[model samples]
Target: MGLCLLISCGESGKRTSVDPGTDTQDISSEESKPVNTPGKKTIVFFGNSLTAGMGLEPEESFPARVQEKIDSLDMDYKVVNAGISGETTAGGESRISWLMRDRVDIFVLELGANDGLRGIPLSETRENLQAIIDTVKNHYPDVKIVLAGMQIPPNMGPEYTAEFREIFPDLARANQAYLIPFLLEDVAGIPELNQADGIHPTVEGQRKVAQNVWEILKPIL
Candidate 1:
């Protein structure tokens, strides 16, 4: 796959072929505008900047796009963008409780990309992700989960990259959750789909991402 350049970019500071570091600020509090409707269920997109729509407007993000699709179909569900730029699995695990306060019917997990970029231990990443999943399950036993898979360049060695890619599906299977083979799919590594940073997706790219998620998410709804 040409997804070697599909590494999630949000963490600020140094950059690399694998790490297109941008912003690592946590904005989930402001971005995750959860609307509670009496009868409507909720779909919470929990992840990093790619989920946050870093350089783009909040509505331009894939979660918002998913919301648009749901509304167009008159689905009885609202989307909550709980994405924070530059969030690692550890960070997400730490704050998972805060997000759990709201009712979550469908939970989409999109972390671990930054951990891959930072060369965090694969075991550690897996553990944190599992913990996050466990937290969500503890809060809402009936909530459905959709895990977003990610890929990184071979900068961290082919073994590391390959294993990093396997974490998502393995976890999804173990937890009996749904999986999006690769979150970026057609949008990654394509210069036209990304912004000037050549990392984060542009508006059109976000739309493609939404389609990718929809393919799997649609069946669940």
Candidate 2:
């Protein structure tokens, strides 16, 4: 089982874009305003290598890039990169308590990619993810959750691929979490944006991912 850890960052950079319809933007002009007063709000991203920045620098990862964008927008929130390289949903479920140690205002759950890659039972993956959601909600009822969906390679077989693809939305609805239909979006399958492994994203690819996540994140922020 894989386990992704989240990290906090302090940085700023240019804005990125995601696909239309799913895109979200900020309307507030102020930067770093207190979102809830007194304490700072932290958004934790939970997942595997995709969220862990396996082949990329910590700063180049999508979570960091999103943090930079959020800072620029003046949203008083902290982005925590809790991505564990090679982690599965089962691994994530086991670490929810430690991960949620902080006062997490939101959670961006991005697990199950490795589970799909390893051909783990979809039912098992669903059970693990649902448990993670339940635990997080039980501990932090006010924490907003954003479920990052994934797609498997077509070679995984049509039936399995379809089931794997449907898990994210189903979990999002059941848990009442915000859904980002696909984490890779324009980045995945685009040879230019991906690294040599064809698994992780290039620097440009991560930027595209940040944009992809931002679209759904902006509205919630």
Candidate 3:
């Protein structure tokens, strides 16, 4: 697959099976609220459908898989999946404050891909992401931050696509946050890794994603 497929996959992946306008709004009001589990550290996976595991069951999502890994290690961290299908960076900026109600030990920020796909202004995307990071820092000064990098196809123009790729790392360095180079690393364009929509990852693909995340996250625990 070419770079175009990468960006195309993200665009379609964000909306999954629903209408773009209708589905990409707010994630479930219920899911937006984070519930802290007593006696456990919290890890919040915040992003769009990829984080939400759009085409799969809640347990089948990468966040859920991460939970399984933590359990095996007998770690006491709660993985909260705050992913919403079709969410954009602006949506995440607005929604993040609500999830701050509970304690968050590690925050994995995974929002920008949708904004990139929709041709949202890079400034707006960067600002929204920065705001999110700022809010997290303000709420929990000691919380660890993890930024997931995203890449889009050059359909948006080489300059735009290149800049989009730079956002995550730049934010990471600025915030001193951990960075996962690409959330969909091995799963993006592989036909078998993706679902029928050629967007969302299949079950096995999610596992690969979980591994990608785990590589960066395990040491934090």
Full-model lDDT for every candidate: 0.84, 0.73, 0.83
Give stretches of model 1 more than 4 Å off. 4-30
Worst 10 residues of 1 by lDDT: 13-22
Clashes of 2: 14
If scored against the real structure, what TM-score would every candidate get?
A: 0.90, 0.82, 0.91
Residue 69 CA error for candidate 3 (Å)? 0.2
The residue pairs that clash in candidate 1, if any, are 10-23
lDDT of 1 by residue, 10-126 (tens): 345221211334333333454464657898999999987788787787788899999999999999998988877667888778788778877899999999988998899999999
Best candidate (score: lDDT): 1
| C-alpha positional error of residue 17 in candidate 2 after TM-score superposition, expressed in Å | 29
Q: Which residue ranges in model 2 land beyond 4 Å of their true spot? A: 1-38
Stretches of candidate 3 above 4 Å error?
1-19, 22-29
Local lDDT at 105 for model 3? 91
lDDT of 3: 0.83
Against the correct fold, how does model 3 do in TM-score?
A: 0.91
lDDT assessment of candidate 2: 0.73
